[model samples]
Target chain A: MSGAGEPEVRLLGSWASPFVLRVMVALRLKVVEYEMQQETLGNKSELLLRSNPVHKKIPVLLHNGKPISESLIIVQYIDEIWASTPAILPSDPYRRAVERFWGEYIGDKFSQVIRVLRGSVPGDKDKMAGEMFTALQYLEEAFVSCSQGKQYFGGDSISYLDIAAGSHLAWIKAVEKISGIKLLDEARFPNLFAWADRFCAHPAVVDVMPDPDKLVEFTVKHAAMCAPK
Target chain B: MSGAGEPEVRLLGSWASPFVLRVMVALRLKVVEYEMQQETLGNKSELLLRSNPVHKKIPVLLHNGKPISESLIIVQYIDEIWASTPAILPSDPYRRAVERFWGEYIGDKFSQVIRVLRGSVPGDKDKMAGEMFTALQYLEEAFVSCSQGKQYFGGDSISYLDIAAGSHLAWIKAVEKISGIKLLDEARFPNLFAWADRFCAHPAVVDVMPDPDKLVEFTVKHAAMCAPK
Candidate 1:
């Protein structure tokens, strides 16, 4: 019991990163008390480097000075370390695999949406937009199958899959605004839109997400900086 | 002990897939007997769809009725199920995290190499080759740091990281031959080169890998068929 009392949890993160937000949401959902150290990308703290030397990226979770990097891996680590809690993944093996499949699909396809936002040339932008539309169409189909009259990606409650997809909502909205294109057509994907709403409204998710207005401002400013002179 | 006498494991895979080869190597390493069903990409088998309905891709490892997908996840599942023998991952959390870091890094960077192989035009091929070379340089640096003075990626005895990276050797070699560009310079990255050789020679890896001559022949023939006219 005393051993449990002394275990320290620390998170190194930046506010703008959705990856960091995923870990934050998982910690909040698990009710794990942790210290947060906001890292500056320009002058990264030595602790962050020591924690995650290879990637040297933020969102490093330190459990008793043992660091785990990679946002998804950190989330899984949190779930494993704090096993006596509301499970973030399904108990059934097949269901857990299903959750993982959705998480990976989101990861693999979401980059195309970002690519479109990052594009400068009209032709390149159009090509990427078409790819984004195709990805969204696939997502619509997947969500229809996954939702199956459930409130969340993992069914009744928010799970890791929900966190994985929901974390990108801020970035997605940012890209939509920057590109002046609406990919998440509500009429076309009502269930997916509803799921996104429920996912955003979830207490754990809501608490950790970056301010939408600030995210939009950052995205627009960044886009302007990258725009052809 | 009698529980070990359960139904034989079955793998649904494509011969050319690096992902499938990872599972094949793992199964071989563990000395577990299994059946292999090669899946056709054009018309997937019903069992493949039934086993991994979400992703619907190889490789899916079916142990009795339970299906595990995602090559890395399947590797973990195999490690957990066969806990009585040689551990594929390090027991220490930090080391395990390091192993996973390399696994994810290889996965993230793999597409650059694939892109190089898939490029059509001379200019595009050259650009892709440069990208692949840069990615290989990073791998070389990583190998220098991680495998310094060690026989294997996990330091003696092929661990999951070795198996994960090893699966790509045939593809890498094939790409080199097909693209007429070699990224893994033996002079520049002796450790990585030696590691690759050792990985290929390992009995488990050696037994499961598609023959190198056949791999190069198939890849060259496939490239000709798929190349943009």
Candidate 2:
């Protein structure tokens, strides 16, 4: 259906957002060409606001002018619309459900851990680090079973879960560097540690992922600004 | 493939949980035969713990020994595996994405609003009531667009978004009764208000829905138990 000429695809995102990186990775993985618009936080563009009235956040995908918001939902929309080789989601429904479960897990559980590590949420750093380790340990077990002895969670190819969790790679590194927290310990979470490396190095992800050093600087500055007067 | 002589389906849930009610509605909708195991709070069953090791929450659907946690994920699994009439999600991917966006909105936004209303999270009741009304207003707009003048978000059928938001109907009512904070104001959110009535009365949902009066009593008792002496 998209053969009605190349679909006009546009992505609204910021430079450092991991969520935006997710949409970028998906587009690159699917080989879909799109125009990227950089958005500045606190002074959002009207288009971004209009596109996603509910969340009013970035990484809204405009497919031939119809906007799809939410990073994961937009990725799914890309996967569905493109419908080409190298599917983002698995073909089987059960497998798809499993992927979704982990994706939600990454968004909910791991995201909170990252927030704690970044000092975005006030918490005992030691306690949060332990919680982070426990969550990654769970994901390590999940990767072993879900990957089926493959390189990525998608099993030899990048898939939904990969993009979902993988998008947070730079942020993970940045948080670890800034907080002196050893989260992705190779010995403790060997599978997840390796997967993180592979995911960051992937063709679709390498160019798009935020630099860990720059992220550290940004996160530190942002945290300082947000601290009480 | 589930024709492997009636797959053993069991649902682990607590009676008062809206999340649990979602799975119940989905099963009833699909006409899927399932064993319902009631779990008591403070005394969770080992099966419940084993089935959902991560969140360790109720509403875990055990399908032929494979456990799927999370209410929405379980509903999708049921829809996929059953693959029968009255699909929970829309067939078109774009439409599915739209429904998913709203489903997630209900879970994230509406759920938070409800939490505030219940006094579960300490907050000014007036501010939370305003937020609850604002969220409902958004849903009202979402229904108008998504429903396309149809009776339900699924367009003539009670679909994913319906079950997701519908499960919380009793809780919404109970909060209204307990706090006297009106959320689903018919005058303001006519579409969603009417949709709520229709959703509650749906065959798949009616019997499984927790009684609003009972829920009010339970919520009050539970809140009292947790209150500071």
Candidate of highest DockQ: 2
For residues A1-229, what per-residue lDDT tens digits would candidate 2 score against the true structure?
Answer: 3446545898999889989999999999999888899998688999999999988998898887788999999888889888998999988877888889889887776678778888778888888788777778878887998899999888989999999989988988989998888888899888898899889888999999999999888888887877789
DockQ of each: 0.32, 0.75
| Candidate 1, position B162, lDDT | 86
Error of 2 at A80 (Å): 1.4
Model 2 chain B scores worst on lDDT over the 10 consecutive residues at B1-10
Span of 10 residues, lowest total lDDT, candidate 1 chain B: B114-123
lDDT of 1 at A193: 81
After TM-score superposition, the amount by which residue A144's alpha carbon in candidate 1 deviates from its true location, in angstroms, is: 7.7
- The TM-score between candidate 1 and the true structure equals 0.77
Give per-residue CA lDDT, model 2, range B34-59, as digits (tens). Answer: 88889988889999899888888988
**Root-mean-square deviation of every model:** 5.3, 2.8
Task: List lDDT for all candidates, in order.
Answer: 0.77, 0.87
Task: Name model 1 segments beyond 4 Å from true.
Answer: A1-12, A35-57, A62-68, A114-151, A155-157, A173-194, B1-9, B40-57, B62-69, B81-84, B114-151, B175-191, B227-229
